[model samples]
Target chain A: MITMTRETLFNLAMMAALILFPLWAWLADEPFMITLATKAVILALAGVGLNIALGLGGLVSLGHAAFFGIGGYAMGILASHAQNYTPLIETPFLIEGTKSMPVIWLVAVICSGLAALAIGALSLRTSGVYFIMITLAFGQMLFFFTISWPAYGGEDGLSIYVRNGFPGLNTLDPIQFYGICFALLALVLFFAARLARSPFGLALNAARQTAERVETVGISPYKLRLTAFVVSGMITGLAGALFADLNRFISPTMFSWQTSGEIMIFVIIGGVARLFGPVVGAVIFIALEHLLGGLSDYWHIYLGVLLLLIVLFARGGVIGTLTGREVAHD
Target chain B: MTDPMMTDPVLETRGISKTFGALQASKDISLTLMPGEIHALIGPNGAGKSTLIKQIAGGLRPDAGQVFLQGREVTGLDTPARARLGLGRTFQISALAMEDTVLQNAVLGALGASGRPFRFWRAALGDKDLRARAQDALERVGLQEHAATRTAELSHGQRRQLEVAVALTLRPKAFVMDEPMAGLGTGGSLRLTGFLDGLRAEAPILLVEHDMDAVFALADRISVLVYGEVIATGTVEEIRANPDVRSAYLGDEA
Candidate 1:
């Protein structure tokens, strides 16, 4: 018999709300609501990606925006080339750009994964505050590089003429786009949940808790962390592509430190290592921004206060508060 | 006498020397852990017993020496690489994953022993082979009943037992245990001493310990370290009788 813990029950409810609320918005003909929900979903997906490295793996990367931005650029460069009817690289056996969502996602995943491999290899060598600073530095370097490159519109950013095409749906339809983003989020969430229970995940989690113990158990913490970081970056990069598609624009701000901080905030506010933590965090964060933005221009003061409360009192975040501290065995 | 030329030591450290600035932490420390023998390394505090163990366990690089496992030189390998090569170890302080359950901690050791821990699809707890290995180790340590209990919740003695259980999962060629009896009470030390007596038959142990009674009770051979050098290495009787060991370590107790 499968016993559902409160955390499990809460996770189910969160997933249900994510789907049902978006569905209700579509039914009520509130396209704007659907768009907002889609934004939350994409942001949550990025947080899920970060959660693997930061939460489970205990890598406090302040440079994930590098992967996010790369993913955005992957979509932007590909879509723009498709619009202009130009090949991406004529010398490399004529590689033409495609406006296909699947293709863009693949490019985004690969680019971000490679970047993660490079960054994680170097950055994972140092831990604690040094790790955070190195990641932040790498992100800043990417931000500066993108601004100076000028070919991809530099600081002005690249605007996709049309949203990338999915095989079966109208990409322009708000509900259809929301469905795609929601489906991806659910799929990735499922993957993340499975990963947390897998052998690799167990080893990675062990590494986070006691690295020396992990080492003595014949697993290199470095290898485990690097692999997790790469996987994390790939997921976030995929979200970056979807995020750019949602706005029909890509910018260097995607690589900004604020983006990395926001991704981390979602994980922290939800519950550091909890599976659905990011989803709950992103939804609540978006909700607060929307509700409080109209109330005052200094609405950040309120977010600051709430974040302080969560950090000081609810170290486990929203899920931790609701479900209690006892982690689910399964 | 078992000739050194005829049989290979399970673990051997030759000319292992390490200096921390002006102080010599380990001075030409040569020791051998023969097959199926509990070789106890006993020293007073600040005798650099830990420094020698660190070099053997691959935590610290020695200025000069060689660490051989099963007759193969593994001096250059890192801690994990040495572990993978069958050098199981337990720390002086408990190094368990406190948040994880006892079973999870054992399973992690089993996963490391499996040689293919990179698999990310199937649930680790559900893997029959890994579970069986972890269960068998826990059962050996008599901790099978508390398999689901969080490691942090386990008693101090239980955590030590859990550490041994984790090491057992390695199926190691040798065990390098540092101060396994450090925080244990008299009863706990006695129980662990009895356990270690039987464990040496599976894999020879290089035990660094403070509890002399447990060391005397368990060690097939004892090496006494003084000021980062082994003053005497012999059977328990010889070590107890050694004048150098008496003056430097055993002291008033001897």
Candidate 2:
């Protein structure tokens, strides 16, 4: 048998807790708790997506909400059209809406990927604060565009009354839907793990630390960062699609910069580069929201204080504090 | 096959120049590195040795003239493109991924040369050949023992050795090195000088150094630069004898 390190053991325990917590909530007839877990899983998925860029590639994107919103809208527009039995566009190449989960996922991932390519191409031209502002600008542009776009419910947002069906599964059952989401989170976590250890990941990590060294080694940092950004956007877009389905609603708020910040917060608080850091972070954040939110109306005050503490004393983040070794120590 | 004694040279530059606003950092410098030979570029601080190296390595574009690896004009290509075409370089500063292991740094270099750094499906740690190649590179620098140690934890001299180990993975046709002995102690320089002496059999070296003793010991030919111009280029003894080189660069020390 292979020996498991403390990190691996901790990761396994966390995954188990994620699965069992929702199950126990369901058994205890707490639908609200189950829903909370589902939200955490989906949000963790988004965090995983961001971690690839922010942690691995060191590309801090403030416009990731653009991709997330694109995904939500992709699901919203397609499901809404399918429900109304309307063709999406009246062009010569007639386009129809889809209600299939697989189809929605494909569209959502593609739309976000395309949006990311465009945004990355423009934002990547500038580095550091410039990159951050350009990305935020793109997010704001998308947010306003969605508000103005009256065709798909605009500022009020679109609603999917019925959850889309996955193959061989009744997505109507809360447990089934949660299972699908949890499974996807696991799959993506697996992908993130594989990616973080791949040769590309090594090169990207090198690019993040020292572009000059990466260049002298015969690899383009620009190309690596761009690829990572696109992949990150696509994954976050997938999470957004699932999130919309879970809530049965999609709104312009999905495109807010605050969503981008929250997603980044998960990566930071958990552990920037650790595979399961975001998962642990999401759980901690949700627990804090539930526990502290009950005690005070201004919960953000506590959240801000906690974040300050983590940044000051526990800069390596929750996982870093637990392991003593840095998450970035590959 | 290559003519070691050929005048055509393995790497060459023609009239390369760069202007940083009012400051003309490098100006119309021409140089060459023949196969199986070490060509040293020696100049005092701010003599534009680094600027010329950057121009040749594609970090900075020369305001005038061209750079050639073999016979191809690569003036417009970027640094990675030049490196991909078998040109290797070592930075004066330790430009390694400090978060990774020494082995991982070498692996990245090998992956760039192998054209498979983009493979995302398989685990990078599972590639036997890649690991072996990286190990071989570390072994070349006599640092295979410390392969698994974090790069940040490596000592200064060890990091410098790791730099050469990383560069060697390129299997370069000619090396463009900038101040390889800038901060080396006596023993470190002696070891590196020995290593560099044996390395020319694999490929020619274009060395930029401040250490006159190491220069005279290793350089088959030397080019003395003064204020971004090649004041003299000749055999070590000839360069030592050149009055312009002595007055402008070497001074009374020559």
Q: Going through the candidates in order, what fraction of the true interface contacts does each contain?
A: 0.88, 0.83
Candidates in order, TM-scores: namely 0.98, 0.98
lDDT against the true structure, each candidate = 0.94, 0.89
Tens digits of per-residue lDDT, candidate 1, A1-330, equal: 899999999999998998899899989999999999999999999999999998899999999999999999999999988999989999949999999999999999999999999999999999999999999999999999999888789999989988999999999999999999999999999999999999999999999999999999999999999999999999999999999999999999999999999899999999999998889889988998899988998887888888899999999999999999765776
Report the number of clashing residue pairs per model: 0, 0
Which whole-number lDDT from 0 to 100 does residue A148 have in model 1? 88
lDDT per residue as tens, model 1, B15-90 = 9999998999899999999888999998889999889988999999999999999889999999999999999999
CA shift at A319, candidate 1, in angstroms? 0.5
Model 2 bad stretches (over 4 Å): A328-330, B1-7
Error of 1 at A179 (Å): 0.5
Q: Scoring each candidate complex against the real one, what DockQ results?
A: 0.91, 0.80
Worst 10 residues of 1 chain B by lDDT: B1-10
